[model samples]
Target: MTIAAYTLAAVLNVFILFIGVRFLLQPFAAAAGYGVPATQDRAYLEIKGVRDTTFGVVGLVLLIFAGAQAEAWYMLAVALAPIGDTFIVLRHGGSKAVAFGVHLATAAVVLISSALLFLA
Candidate 1:
């Protein structure tokens, strides 16, 4: 249980880091993949990149230094970002399939990771 929890958390953090980098490097492509096609505003995409990168780093820092309980709390709180994303995608004329399949599924995985960390 402990191993699974830690591994999953680490993988999630790394994945988020990759996503952040993607957003920073290829904002338009990242936005399309995020279930919302971005317009002319470059700032928003850059902000999202920063936000995700920070989240990934923070999660890793918490897990490494603060331990499982702290990581669990962090995961629980951070899950809201994805949940909010689910709605954002839906409301912004994004595809329902992408909105639910990607963002909602991500939220569920984050929540499950939180629960696992809690149990660990």
Candidate 2:
């Protein structure tokens, strides 16, 4: 359980970091994958990239320096991003499948990670 908890948290953090980088480097593609299309203004896409990057770094820092409980709390709080994303996609004329399948599923996984971290 301990190993699984830590591994999951680490993997999630790294994966999010990768996503952040993808958003920064390939905003259009990233946005498409995120269940939304990029508009003319790239500002928001860049902001999302930075936000996700910061979150990934923070999660990794919490797990490494602050321990499982802190990581658990962080995970619990960060889950809100995906929850909000679900709505964002839905409201933006994105497909329901992507909205729920991607964003909601991510929220569920993040929540599960939080629960596992708490148990750890």
Candidate 3:
């Protein structure tokens, strides 16, 4: 249980880190893949980077500093972010595949992490 919880947490942390970096380095690519493109605007790009990076680091901190129980709550709440991301992508001219594949999958992973943390 401990291994599962920690593994899930680590994977989420890394996944979020990748997202943040992608958003920063490939803003247009990331936005387009996210289902909404910012029209010649840098602000949204930076915002995306900030948002993803914050989520990643916060989740990491929760796991490392607060322990499994707090991380469980964090995962449960943070699941909503990806659920919303799913809708955002689906509603904003994003493909069904990306919406379900990426965002929904992420939500599921978060939920599973919550369950594992609970068990731990």
Model 2, span 25-108: residue lDDT tens: 998889999998986667788888998999999999999999999999999999999999999999999989999999999899
Q: What tens digits encode model 1's per-residue C-alpha lDDT throughout 1-120?
A: 999999999999998988988889999999999999987698899899999999999999999999899999999999999899999999989999998999999999999999999999
Cα lDDT of model 3 by residue, 95-118, tens digit: 889899989998998999999998
At residue 103, candidate 2 shows an lDDT of 90
TM-score (C-alpha) between model 2 and the true structure = 0.97
Q: What local lDDT does model 1 show for residue 73?
A: 93
Worst 10 residues of 2 by lDDT: 38-47
**Residue pairs with clashing backbones, model 1:** none
lDDT of 1 at 53: 91
Whole-model lDDT per candidate: 0.93, 0.93, 0.88
> Which residue window of length 10 is worst by lDDT in model 3?
33-42
